[model samples]
Target: MPNKHLFFLLLLTAMALALPSYYFDSNSIRFIFFIGVVAIWRYLWALQHFIRALFFLKVKFKRLRQQEQAIGEIADPKHIFILVTSFRIETDTSILVYKSAIAEAIRLKQPVTIIASIVEPSDERLIKQIFYNSAPPLRVSLKLVRIKGSGKRDGLAVGFRAISNSQVDLESAVVAVVDGDSVLTENCIKNCYRFFSINPKLGALTTNESCELTQSSRTLAIYRRWYNLRFAQRHEFMCSVALSNRVLTLTGRMSMFRGDIVGSSEFIDRIEFDYIDHWRLGRFRFLTGDDKSSWFQILKDGWQMLYVPDVKVLTIEQPPHNNFIKGATLLMVRWFGNMLRANTCARQLPRVVMGSYVWWLLRDQLISIWTSLFGLVLAIMGGLYYGETIFYAFAFWILLTRYLLSALLSTLHGHFSLSWPILLYFSQIYGSMVKIYVLSHMYRQVWTRQKTTLKDSGNRLEHFIRTFGSNIALLGSASIFLTVVAFIAGVLTTYDIQAFISYYFS
Candidate 1:
């Protein structure tokens, strides 16, 4: 079902055309060669994904046929545990999620237990009403776990403990961690269980996600919708990575795990108190990225994780800030910070433990930030001295390539829009800048959705100094660095103001 190879081929073709248009002249040969090297790396990355996606498709089709044959026969049902954690979640979203969970449980024809972890007592009452109101053929048990208005980690810990104490079969039972904002599709439970039944080695699995935007502003709505579409593209890439027994992140939006894995004390401990040894701040606790913590535990335990592309979950997405740009920036800060923190430890793991592809991805994360900025700077300087033709070519290249890629991906995923190509540019340029900033401020963590803030370090003064000081320093350094680079680029490119004036005058 994934068109990863086709997408890559089309992208490569577009880039090939665009690259020559900007770099065909002798004056830009160095720039051309530099970009060519970067393009080769991109090509290899794409090729690797294509190969893995093809392999996954072949295996998935064969497995599906076998599963279809087994579907008619009544298989012994496994105890299904659904943990729904919410902290100030929208009432509508919560109700929808509960209904979907109940519906899916009924479809599976399994003994189901739903654990609802809520910080607000009001949410608990509302969720209970939704659960009781459901009229499923099979009896679905409900467990309500109340928590102080602490954090998602605390909420999850409560649910995890409840599931552990319950009388569920550890070996065969499966635990689905569903975010309160996400509604599971009808086939989600059935499809996930099929994979588990077929592959004993599959430790944990996550499903594909679609987002529902709750914005009234047309501009913000477009941004959110396109942003989610890009997320789907990312999911496809992750699915391909999973063919090699590695997924970059186990998305918390909706992920399924073995009962034993979820019930383990280690998993709960990691979720609640996961931390990294920061050189500057010493040992620091993770305030977010619970998904990453779960992923690290699974990877460390030698469990084979997977991405079930066929399974879909609908997640309700609301912007954290009023301004679209501000909201997007805050989201990226939290996201990239979580990633970089986890990556610190992930890089130290053996290649056999994480797989070679994951290792390369970790390295690529570090390299990509600098490369992106460099490319942007080069284009700007090339335009300033070499004439607007070079810049026009660059802009045309980005627009054409991104539009083609978005169109192709839309055909595959059915979420394409005319605005997606423009959003693609924003994601690359603006998102890359955000990632670079987040990398520097890896110690900071905030739950933008829940309006929760955590200090980067223990001491208030130290946290302030580290957070604000680092930001200011980065700003100053970037300004100076760009200025010098621009000057150098202009000088090296040998621009002639006299020739430009004469030509214009003539």
Candidate 2:
């Protein structure tokens, strides 16, 4: 669901459609023209992200690997105030996240405080237990500031209030918002401080979200594993890389704000309004645009956001087989909402249009969807002309090629297992179908929010079919076109060779 995967899917679709088209009709100038336009636009956007990534990568690469180089390092760990937003911390996952963060805070030996927001109104016992369990000295100082509310925004607002009310000086302390489910690495705090010290322009630093899909023994762990790997390896880190200037959102999962940055009345205004009204009424808002909203605020305030890859955390992914449909559906819905929200923010913040970033984001989304639909139509047309066998064969070839490519990429990246190729294949099939359903579902959700029916738990399969059918059809068309090109090439080679022989003999 990350924009990275969406772009990758778009690129794959574009390649499948455009590459084979060269063989089918060399003289089709319009086709070539369209392909060129898409390719150029994609390259420019990628170039921006790539440049920023390279800069950070080079700095980190030298710092960690090179001993001779006196690269940036945190001499004195800055005074940091940790803000963890949680409804209740009784859950095993929540407890573990707190423990890890506490351990890291202790490791850094910095003054840290935790403010947990009690979101469930009826779960007084749970909240009490959570406070009782997390009480006192793990390493650094800790406080359990409980707020009365039942939503993500409420928790966030509560946390913000606690920080504001606390004696901690907002100007000097590093204010980091760590999600309840995120586990920080040992040196995460150190790396974050280091990033802040080196880049004075950076108002915030976000740790790379190192997520993994885990479950009990046996089942689709392999699939979950690969999915998480793809997500973390690329998407999780992309926001920092891609949105260097015009950051739309700072993720709540593992993002750090300078004490001064969030402590400001301007930045505090973010916690003031949830969506429409103030934070209290819309506290339990179901929308997942919190991160996007933060990014928008930072950009509006003219502060840059930095990403420290070394500051890694293991964010747990929702298991795929158990909750695939619900999970995927939620993902698509959230993404659609995020985009809509981002568009609104972009309009308010016209600086977003000053660069290629917005264009890249919008262009890719529109064209990618178009490519998927176009492929489906072409495949249906090809089938009507050629036959069913040809269509099926094309599908098989497309699947095979995708699996091989993904397998190779995973192997090279060393993030996925040997079995990743097969999982990638299934993901392709399932993801495509899910995408199609998502496209339709997104439209419905956006257009007719009031009359929306409850989604079935097992809707991923249905969504997968809707999404993948178009992809299969497109691949089929590409295959038929490739086949025709192969035939033409063979005939032309034969004719040229015969002509050459006849001329030589004469």
TM-score of each: 0.86, 0.66
Model 2 TM-score (2 dp): 0.66
lDDT of each: 0.76, 0.54
Worst 10 residues of 1 by lDDT: 488-497
Backbone clashes, each candidate:
0, 14
Q: Residue by residue across 1-506, what tens digits does model 1's lDDT show? A: 13754575576567567554435565676456335555557546656665566567568645754774586534334788989998889887888888888777777677888888998888878877877777655557888999997999999999999998987777778888998889888877766765666667778888788888775664677667656667757755875787777687888888988888889999999999999987755678899999999999988887888887767789888877767788878888888888889988788888888877777888988877665566567677877776666665666566666766566556446576656777877877887888767766777678878978774435788777777866875687677657655655654422564666678997
Q: Each prediction's Cα RMSD?
A: 6.9, 12.3
> What TM-score should be assigned to candidate 1?
0.86
